[model samples]
Target: MAVGVPELKIERVRQNYLANLVAAIACFLLEAGWYSAFMDTWINGIGRNRQWLENTGINPAIQYGTALVMASIMATAISCVTQLTGKQTALRGIKVGALLWAGFELTTLATEYIFEVRPISLFLVNAGYWFFGMTLMGAIVGGWKKKV
Candidate 1:
């Protein structure tokens, strides 16, 4: 019985891992596609008027889009973990999403420092982007149990 129990646990873990992988990949792809489409109108419209944005060669849409895609992937992965563990809740989803966003932000900041690139005011922009992005993903995944 002990051996069987261990095997069962391993199988469950494997299944959840696969599920999280699939969810993350799917979420990333979908969000990326959405961002690509959104960038066209966004860049030429609202972003064109900002002098700093123009001089910096930074595309707000692209940056925000990438952040959104990453946030979605992370939120989906967390949702999968929580679901598998039978502790799925909106608060847990939010916490996971926030952690994911923070992780990405730290990595980006570190990379920028290493490359000797000027900080592009990414902290504010990314914070807002990830907050909304992850919140939306969490709400969707935690609020809805439908398979992705």
Candidate 2:
């Protein structure tokens, strides 16, 4: 609509809510495994752990609910991106997901951690999850709609 962009028709679909839910669950489970495997180092780095969260009176429901919400948002966003780019297939989605991880997730998280003086290990752990998780989500969502 402006600048070097050309006008094009944007097709709208129901957006596949079921696919989004599946992707969300997949990513959430992946996150859980990732954190669990690295919990010792991760918790020491943050000086926090499961007991800390519980002692603070944080509800497990809140944590899970937040994860679901975030995963759903990621799924929907990837779907839109795939549709806009005319990208089909899980492989294509993986590429898009990588680019997004590099451009958006990596950049933002790195910047925040740098300022906070957090260790690079922490950043690597978190960013590594996003890197793989985003690609996995893209693969699932990409396979859902082969074409825009």
Candidate 3:
């Protein structure tokens, strides 16, 4: 309708909530296992131990809930980007996941680690978990498309 401007066609993206939920849960569980595996190194890297952690008075529910919520958000974002960019597939999702981690999560953590003088081991422990977790979630959500 405009003189030299083309009409913008907005396409609707159908989100698979089930896939997202599954991805989030998977991410959360991966976190648990990752941390458990690196518990000693993590505690040491933070300059604390089991005793300090137990005495921190942080509620387990809050911590777990936060992780779940964050994972859900990340999974949804990956799915959205995967769908918007091109044909949605497990490989695309995985690539998107890794790229997002490198672009956002890894960079952010690297800055914090540098400024806070945190150990590389700790960074690896935390960042590695996210890399794997996000990729796994991406694969799930990307592959599980909503029926048209």
Candidate 4:
């Protein structure tokens, strides 16, 4: 019984880790597609040309890339939390998702600020994206159940 219990615990942890990873990948790809299709084109047309990437100022590529990475991390964290809590509750999921979003938002803002760049407006825009994306991801993950 003791040996079986340890094995079962390890298995559960591994399962949760895998689920989180899958969730991260799915969220990352989805966000990346949206960004590439719309935001990238718009930025390139309005803000700078492709060759401007070689300049030293805040490159839009770095900003978008950072946001994508942050979204993946948030998705993974939400998935792991939902799995560990074992409560497929929407409220719980949203709470976890929101917290993760806030963390990333604040971190990104701080990084931009430290670099002497204007970040409040960008943070606001990214916050909206995070809110919707994470809410959707949380709802789906929280509603998923594993059968014994």
lDDT per residue for candidate 4 within 1-148, as digits (tens), equals: 6765664453242234444455555666666665555565545434565566546589777876786667566666687776566566666767667766677655765587557654454444455656667766676566554455
Give Cα-based local distance difference scores for all models.
0.54, 0.85, 0.93, 0.61
lDDT of 3 by residue, 1-148 (tens): 9799999977667789999999999999998899999999999999998999999899999999998998898899999999988899999999999999999999999999999999999999999999999999999999998887
Ranking by TM-score: 3, 2, 4, 1
TM-score of 3: 0.93
What RMSD does each model have against the real structure?
8.2, 3.2, 1.6, 7.4
Total clashes in model 2, counting residue pairs 3 or more apart in sequence or in different chains: 0
* Clashing residue pairs for model 2: none
Q: Which candidate has the top score in TM-score?
A: 3
With a 3 Å backbone cut-off (N, CA, C), the pairs that clash in candidate 1 are none
- Give the poorly placed runs of model 3, Cα more than 4 Å off: 1-7
Q: How high is the lDDT of residue 15 in model 1?
A: 26
What is the C-alpha local distance difference test score of candidate 3?
Answer: 0.93
Q: How well is each residue in 2-115 modelled by candidate 2, as lDDT tens digits?
A: 899988876764477888889899999999999999888788778788798569877889999999999999988887787667746788777788889999999999999999
TM-score of 1: 0.46
List runs of model 1 lying over 4 Å from the truth.
1-75
Name the lDDT value of residue 141 in candidate 2: 85
